[model samples]
Target chain A: MRRVAIVQGEYHVVYQPGVVISTLLGSCVAACLQDPVARVGGMNHFLLGEPGADVPVNPADMQRYGVHAMELLINDLMKRGAQRSRLRGHLYGGANIVAGLGGIGTKNGQFARNFMRTEGIALDHCDLGGTQARKVEFMPYEGRVRATLVQDQPLPPVERPRPAPVAQPTGELELF
Target chain B: MPAASAIKVMVVDDQTSMRAMIRRALQDLGFKDIRDKAGPVEALAAIKADRVHLIISDYNMPDMDGLQFLEAVRQDPVIGKTVFIMLTGSADKEIVQKAAALGVNNYVVKPFAPAALKEKIERVFGELV
Candidate 1:
């Protein structure tokens, strides 16, 4: 099977069978969308929802935003013969991973959900926010998805002191 | 503006590579006192223990996101006026607005070059010498 790995701000569409799209996500969201009847599908990874009013965004980096990423993925899929009305989505990623960091993952997940709803796309499965990072694999042509949690490093074991040996009564009291 | 060598700056991010990248950028800009922490909680504590002139932080972090960290800094009397610059992967409107509302001095999107980082700092502290 052919495998394609996409990082933040990237999307891939496939109409051929045996093609898998994958990504590792942390505080980012990936949307796997497919049109079963048309046998076409694709995936997109976005870092955030949209650029703020005062924030200056370079044109080259626009696709990193959710708004543009979504549009581009959907449009690309449609261009490959996928129908917008028959679209189905499976959302993944958006894990916080760190305890104190703000909920960027949560916000990303929310944006994906809202976008799907507002665009009238049917969401069949979703595995969003949590404290663990995720690795998502999508079979675009088959419209099949598998999401697994990426394990964090385990804590080191604590060292315990060995018990002191009991002394026999030798009666040898040396004066200091 | 204080000399880059004299001004103490703190770079906070959960990723080690990101912290190193920012540290290297700051070093390239002739910044001497650059300290980094992996998360906002420790960064906040370090600021309270010893004041820094400026803070360059990533928006997505564990144990307190960048906005929360900014709010904590803004609410504190000692470090309330510190110049802050946010580093984010995306220029998401909500994150930007929130950071601005929390009194961020400026922000630089991720995948930025050293020159861009320097420009953002210059915007906050005037020309760096």
Candidate 2:
């Protein structure tokens, strides 16, 4: 069984992947975790590196930041019978799509890297930070991920534009 | 024309899936003569060649934009008198005014429910019934 989720805006979710926890990313980031031994895993998407001020969260906003999103994903796996020593992570999305954001994507990537290292989880593999939004399909059962990168701006009506060609750059935008 | 057969619709949008979705919604509402196009150019061709009674178009695209499409539709004598409806999320005053000037009958913004679209279509063409 496969399930898909489109993560955008002020949203946070937690799920145990009996199969997969799939999502897409723009200026956001998602951290995936798997307990190879326990065979338990899940993932999450957060809008920005810093969630900023004024947004109220259910439990607390302090632990809802970017750094904490990763921490939470990891800890969730551990709670599901994952040993900290055997847990592995894969990161996606921190694209420089929005130009002149003061290297916001780069900052997010660094935050994820530091958080992973600091938390003592061995970073098995990572594909992070680029200039494309990605559609990701993760198979927690077999620990496999299929990602699609759609390189086009969402033409929200406010920007009344012209006709367009349907040819899109579809490929493995990145692999890490 | 009677409301039962009063209006034919042309749905224009850049997203293939979204266009299909709008078409499905139109079908569910019993809108006959529902034709969909991905870009304004194709839509313009359809407008020029066909007897479209109404239009529902997405505002943002790469080729001919919604406003230009609407203008082209109005300029074409073949279907100039047909009503227009814009289904989009654009809040631009200039664009809206231009569409209004073109004699568009109605508009539906983005992130809308199917019932909302049905309501607008019903409102604009409701008297036909």
Candidate 3:
């Protein structure tokens, strides 16, 4: 079986048999859309929503956003002969691994939910929003989806150097 | 004087939002010399041009993954010894082992709070006082 690794901000669709698509996700979200009747499925990995004032200025960078990734994935699925009405969604990732970094995961998950709702696609399964990263695998031809929680193994402690002392101002004042 | 304010910290992530979030957190933590790059390639270029006291990099990127970038830094004589903290979504033991072998100073999982990031930095470089 041929395996295609989906990197961050990318998506792939498969219609042929014996092909597997997989991705590693952290705060990013991956939406697996499958047309069960047509046996056509695709997956997308996206980092955030549409670009706004704070987004990167490069137009190519916008492809990583949720809106663009989702559109690309959906369009590919339909282009591959999958019917929109038969499409089912499986959402993964959106884990809040960095608890204090704000809620990119939550936001991505919400975007996925809203995207499905707005597109009229049914969500068949979901594993989203937690502290652990996820590894997702999908067999598009079989409509088999598997999501595993990547282990949160603790790193061994290491010795660190003491902080260097800061230079202090001299008490004597000199006029220039 | 606050310790973190003098440190030159660079944040590298493919996602603009992640970079902005980390930059905001660093600013809130009183870090003054904070620079952000979109990915490892740009970050490497920046490091070659000037030195950064500490680096906070996302693990996954299109050009060079964090581990590969870390290894590259370790090999570089000029900026090899700079403190590096990896920001990853995966806590998998294998990745942790690889990072440790590559001499990463610390690892912070994704979606981390500003306080948590500060704590990790303090753990490596002492408190921000």
- Which candidate, 2 or 3, has the higher lDDT? 3
lDDT of 3 by residue, A37-93 (tens): 888999988887654433222333444677657756765687688877789999998
**Cα distance off (Å), candidate 3, residue A161:** 34
The whole-model lDDT of each prediction reads 0.79, 0.62, 0.77
Clash count of each predicted structure = 13, 11, 10
For all predicted structures, in order, the TM-scores are 0.51, 0.44, 0.50
Across B1-129, the per-residue lDDT of candidate 1 in tens digits comes to 657898899999765545665787688778999999988899989999999999999886646889999999999999999999987654355777778878888887664545657878898788998
Cα lDDT of model 1 by residue, A4-98, tens digit = 99988889999999999998887788999999999999999888776543354554565677776876687678769887789999999887876
Off by over 4 Å in 1: A153-176, B1-129
Off by over 4 Å in 2: A1-176, B1-6, B127-129
Q: Identify the candidate with maximal lDDT.
A: 1
Off by over 4 Å in 3: A53-56, A152-176, B1-129
Query: Which of 2 and 3 is the better model by TM-score?
Result: 3
- lDDT-better candidate, 1 vs 3: 1
Which of candidates 2 and 3 is the stronger one according to DockQ?
Answer: 3
